[model samples]
Target: MTRGVRGATTVENNEAGEIIEHTRTLVLEMAEKNNIKPEDVSHAFISVTKDVDAAFPAKALREINGWKYVPVMCMQEIAVPGSLPKCIRIMMVVNTDKQQTEVEHTFQREAVKLRPDLLEDVQKDQQK
Candidate 1:
């Protein structure tokens, strides 16, 4: 049963370069820990808050990861009256044969503030 994991991060701005680099690192780490292969990724979606507009975070990931064939999409996050100001969220869809509980999701940096439990898990995994 293939499954997908979700993760998110808050960026300094909309510039695709930094957002992309950090996202690539996080995504790769999640994939590695969860035994997911890049080729198995059906798609990777990036959602930026309304204020971000440097480049598509997905494009940066594709370029950095050399995922030329992977489908990528970028969009604006829904505007809430007062939500996290500068956030970039990622939803990775992978063709994995693992149970949902086997998937690992990462929320790093300021994004960790959104989900402390998930961030703690990621930290524990990294220490291993």
Candidate 2:
């Protein structure tokens, strides 16, 4: 089955370096948690809040050893009042045997508050 793995992370600053580093961290964590291989990834869609204009988060994945051929797209997230700032989110679709509920969705830094339910699931998996 094909499943989507979602993740979000907050950058400390609007600098390109910070955005890239944080995005890389988030992607690596998602891949690790879900056992996602580059060959199995269909595509990666990345979105950043309006405040984050330093760089496209997808570009950061180019530096990853096996992501050179994976298709990636970047977009601006809808601006919502009181939403998290400097946030980058990614939705990656991959072909895997795991069911939707088994996929790991990660939220790092202040972004963790965005999905408390998923956080709980991750914690449960760790306790197993």
Candidate 3:
């Protein structure tokens, strides 16, 4: 079955370096948590909040050794009042044997507030 793994993270600043670094962190964590292989990823849809215009989160995927060939599209997130700032979100579509409930969704940094229910899972992974 094909499943989508969702992840979101917040950058400390709007600088390109910060954006890239946080995006990489979020993607790597999602991959590790879900046992996602680059080859199994059909596409990645990345979106950043309006305040984050310094870099494209999708560009950071290219820095990963095997992810160069994976298709990625970057977009601007809909601006909502009181929403997290400098947040980068990704939806990675992967072909996997795992069922929907088996898929792990990651949220880190300030973006963790976006999905409190996943907090325990994220904390457990970090302890390992």
| lDDT for each residue of candidate 1 in 1-128, tens digit (9 for 90 to 100) | 56777887777766767877777777776777777777888888888888877777776666654577788899999999878877888888888877776578777677777778776775786798
By lDDT, the better pick of 2 and 3 is 2
TM-score of each: 0.83, 0.96, 0.91
Score candidate 1 by TM-score against the native.
0.83
Candidate 2 has an lDDT of 0.92
Off by over 4 Å in 3: 120-128
Weakest 10 consecutive residues of candidate 2 by summed lDDT: 54-63
For all candidates in order, the CA lDDT equals: 0.77, 0.92, 0.90
Clashes of each: 0, 0, 0
Best by TM-score: 2
Judging by TM-score, tell me the better candidate of 1 and 3: 3
Whichever of 1 and 3 has more lDDT, that candidate is: 3
* Model 3 RMSD, rounded to 1 decimal: 2.5
Off by over 4 Å in 2: none
